[model samples]
Target: MPLPTADTPWPPVDTRVLTSLADWDAWYSAEPERLEQRYEGRGSLEQANRPAQYAGGLRGRLARWFWGQPTPAGEKSSKLHIPLAGDIARTSSGLLFSEPPALISEHQGTQDRLDAMAKSLHPTLLEAGEVCAALGGAYFRVVWDDEVSDRPWIDTVAADRAVPEFRYGRLTAVTFWTVLDSGDTNDRRLFRHLERHEKGRIFHGLYEGSLTALGAARPLADHPDTAPLAAMVDAEGGLDTGAPAHLTASYMPNVRPARAWRHIPSAAYWGQSDFQGIEGLMDALDEAWTSWMRDLQDGRSRIIVGDHLLQSLGPGKGVRWEDRRVYTGLNMLPRAGDPDPITSVQFAIRVKEHADTCAALTEQAARQAGYSASTFGEHGDGQAVTATEIKARERRSLATRARKALYADPALSDILAAQLAVEAGFRFGVTGLDLSVPPKVEFQDSVTEGLGELATTAELLRRAEAASTETLVRMQHPDWDDQQVTAEVAAILGESGRAVSDPTMTGAEGPGTHGSGPVE
Candidate 1:
């Protein structure tokens, strides 16, 4: 890395500055490093596609014969990545607000239009699902191109590169980083988008690096065309084609109407990765497995030879008893009058104790990950696991999912807000949505329930007509949107040639009663 240029101002960072900032470096690099190690297994980098190392003993040799001692990355990391984080992101991505965002004007048609626009943007906003799993949180930015169209579009920023700047306890700027493609696709130029709020005005600045070697860690500059101080950014930058951007632009005033939402409240930084809390457990489990393998390999066999015969054999091989002049296979010579001279000896090693200890260790590791001993193919104590015990373990896993939802739900709301704002400018298809009024983000819990519990929920939904239809529908199918529910209802009505009238509608009779109105 290079030294930071003292003359450069804030928000413009070169490689040295980026890697130097304590929090920034930790967030973007250090944390990912630790998480990746836990996921791929420690020392994976050093091992890099190599075979396993075994001790020089009977146990080591036996392990190679029985298990083949082929060490691969993540062999220790059974990726107990339960559906918690994934389910949270997957469920939250498809969530809907309790009600459509309200408009300032009381025009029902306009409100409906806005609702339609919101529905259209729902799937786009949901693109952050896998992103959230990769990074504990996901980001949403509203973008528009003056030359292309006036309508705003969504830009989902990866959490690893998205930096939100706060000034006086308020978010004043957001900077996103990307690697710009150069002549070589593998090599890249670093680019940054710094959207800042200054004097009640939004300023957008684009930064590009000059060196192809910048690859992933290019330097940044306020001015685009000037050759980036590679020496100041990275000591290695001079080695690459230190070619700066041919085109440059000054910080230009942004005229877009949307302001970036730093994070959704539910998604306001509350995600815990599968590997987060159990990293130490994973490390210990890996070590235990590795040690167990060594024990199995080195302790399974032994060979012995008589002292006088050993000299004649010279390390397990010598001339046969029949052929005395030259060395021969599977034969040893005995001295004259040598009584009770054992030629060679071999014995099988009983590894029951070592095997049992390994099994126990494997079980303990699995238990730490909230799984049964059998999950990792280790039978501890040789006890059969019951169905009830499995179900209870599954129930315990729900806690992780519940915690993820607490953060993901609010973050989804922030993303939805950005999406709603972007969709506000659509000239056709959607109207009546007010970008000023934030929509309510409602997370539908999709955790598996017992059959009895599911029955109870179904019965309750069937009996209550006024209860939240959306909630009921979500309870049944968490991934379904209002549009899907409508389609399902339409399909059902089409079958009977009759519609189920809404009890809340004006002049409606009873729930599930046939009505003249066609389902929307």
Candidate 2:
């Protein structure tokens, strides 16, 4: 059935909804802030004497070089410790891939078709979605035959572009909006709204632009294929239709029509940034390094040019002695007065201590992000060497990964399902197989813990008869389903030339008995 028109009144959004979305906007801004600190060394040094260091000339260059201050305000630097934390999280999270799960019958064929379609599209969906998840939450929209492109396309809208309408803690509708340049003689507003129907799984688009140089507001015409949208516009060029045409054009056989869209929230239950936890630590590390650099440059050296001695050199008292032997070498010159002529004394700052402290803070930051010292190539002091064992898994990194998977897995599945629906509707056949059965998508996780910890557990299970072979195999390969496990067991027995025996045989222990040997 067709969905309602865009002109129908939407449930009024609560004031808190706007506030919540604003928070997500702030969260998204953090990525650029982090990038600035990482590559540009922004806020690296805000010392009391920063203005002096920024004043151009030989003095500014000397202070910047010797004091470890950032480059002039507009330029960027190569300082990178802050970016390293973000890199660690991304690299350690592992590679996530999509495939058909056990839920779908003949899922392999469905998955292969989805894979081929993904390759044909630009800015592969995987890369786009990952970037959005890292920043906060993103809206994945599957648009077909947009004015900009003829091919079916997947576009990721940032959180700010997607306004999610909620009812009783569930998302009922999502309105994806954007701005366009209408190229009128006068600078006028041009807004576009593409809303998705949650119940009917359809898309409704409306464009409002200044139709003339006078800057008068009017509803723009619909695309040639979407003529039904014209009904929504009233005589005054306002929205009038209460329903929009089903926008997706499907060409595949056996594919049901559905919306191929997904909303991936980086953190569960709300939009949370991946870098929120470690941002403070990164700032602290930068501050510590900045302070150390400032003190090392300004506090550790002194020049003793006396007030009485200044008159001898006149205006040249600010000596150009940098290259002369008199700068570092001791020169005993005759003094006219008996009073001490030494004008100043400067003590060296504790450079080594500050460096060690910063290192410790950096390590703590890594730990908070679920990384160890070894992750950044740093060795812990007096660390113990113990046998490899499966340690407890409760780090922020792991938790974040799990939470993202919780959202991404289902979202990806829905995207592929929608694609299948479109293909089936259009009867656009696959290469070799019949895509009659809708395929369920599953994401394959190739990321593991830092120490290859799973290997030790697998070895222990193989060496000792801790449980039934099936149970052991399941533990080792958690992603494997029951059928795969059974097939593996049968293959093993066949290779060993052993016959299977029933556990409930005569004179044998019945079910529910403990301390039993391997099932074979």
Candidate 3:
């Protein structure tokens, strides 16, 4: 598909897609105001008019405490928001990228290139992972600027900013856009820069538009953002990538089968968000925290006294409570059955109940978001545990990590291949590098077992005579390549004086010989 031109609808997304994206983005933002605004925007007149009906429901109750209207006293309600949504996104990213994946290729030159690229791009990939978790998915586009840098780099486009075209569940093309400038007062023009990726080409279009319409196509130079690209584009306003379409850009879903929008064909390709199906739980958590804080605030000790107990200040000034060693007797006497003039009172704060509620809500939210409570520090008895034990406790989190990696691996590999393809096509930094084979992205296990445990396991296997030297070596050093394992095995055999001569060769002795001597 080509880029949008004049008369095209702006953003090019249906209402469902817009709503889904907006909801996910709002939750991921972790801002109370944004959440409240989102709720208000989606709320109905009926919900607004009938406070009792609205506040009776779970979501309504949460809203009432968290981001609803001010309290009855006319003071703004104080709400404490626990940013578990943001934490989940960050944890998702950290699980996948805490230990950088190895981008390996059979070709040495390609390997070197990938290594260098990974070194420079690790942080970007980590950020992309977090965005993917939060936004359902992210687009990886191969971009370059000779003026900025010699080598082309992979750029991440948030899911909201992209209009992707998919065929048979595969990403065929994508149009990435940004609002470059929204013109000042009278004009009220919205200038948008759109870059559409297709087979062997990238189309760049600058549109002078309103919020809802692609008004007219403008020259790329008209906008500062697309001016540099203007010089690089061909006469048709497209840059020739000289590579396969899919190589230029790829869409990485956070998880498979966007369950929330699965019924909508247009949104089927979209990824599942980490915050999906847990918004209410998250809201309830924030509400619980806020209520707890309000308790603390309202529970403070207070003294009730008659106006006579207050000291009078100057004419216009208000009376103040003065802390004095002794108080003078008032002219008026108290009634026989009346209570004392002053009394101190403090409401009991429900500390345990609130803490338990918050903990339960947090655990439920984490679990609903496909993570273990332990992952979010909701474990019982805060004590250190072995890596194996931690893994056992965080199995759900590990499983979630594995699921995300499945979606990330291919997208990462494709973009990396695209990076190499562009590098080779433009002959940027490295030349003659083989692009025949795409790099493999091997994610390291996020949970690392203790070295002692690993050694013990290897020893047990060796004692059982159930594994070979190669297997033991691999168990000890899982990250080592075949060549490294082979070299290490040879060295170990040589040191142990157990090296056997090859019988196939012209040797003076048989297979049992060691250093040309026959075995006793």
lDDT over C-alpha atoms for residue 13 of model 1: 33
Candidate 1 least-lDDT 10 residues = 246-255
Candidate numbers, best TM-score first, in rank order: 3, 2, 1
Regions of model 1 farther than 4 Å from truth: 1-136, 143-155, 167-172, 181-278, 295-396, 425-430, 449-520
Score every model by TM-score.
0.45, 0.53, 0.87
Question: Candidate 1's C-alpha lDDT?
Answer: 0.41
Ten contiguous residues with the weakest lDDT in model 3: 511-520
Number of the candidate with higher lDDT, 1 or 3: 3
| Candidate 3 residue-pair clash tally | 0
**What local distance difference test score does each model get?**
0.41, 0.47, 0.82
**Model with the higher TM-score, candidate 2 or 3:** 3
What candidate 2 gets wrong by more than 4 Å, as runs, is 1-108, 115-135, 145-153, 181-269, 275-286, 299-302, 307-322, 325-396, 427-520
| Model 2 agreement with the true structure over 182-300: per-residue lDDT tens digits | 45547555445455444325545555533211122233353342345556434433341111222221111001111111133321233444444555566567667767776766785
* Cα-based lDDT at residue 104, candidate 1: 21
Candidate 1 is scored at a TM of: 0.45
Please write out the lDDT profile of model 1 over residues 162-216, one tens digit for every residue: 4554444333345554543444566544554334322212333345444322212
Error of 3 at 8 (Å): 3.0
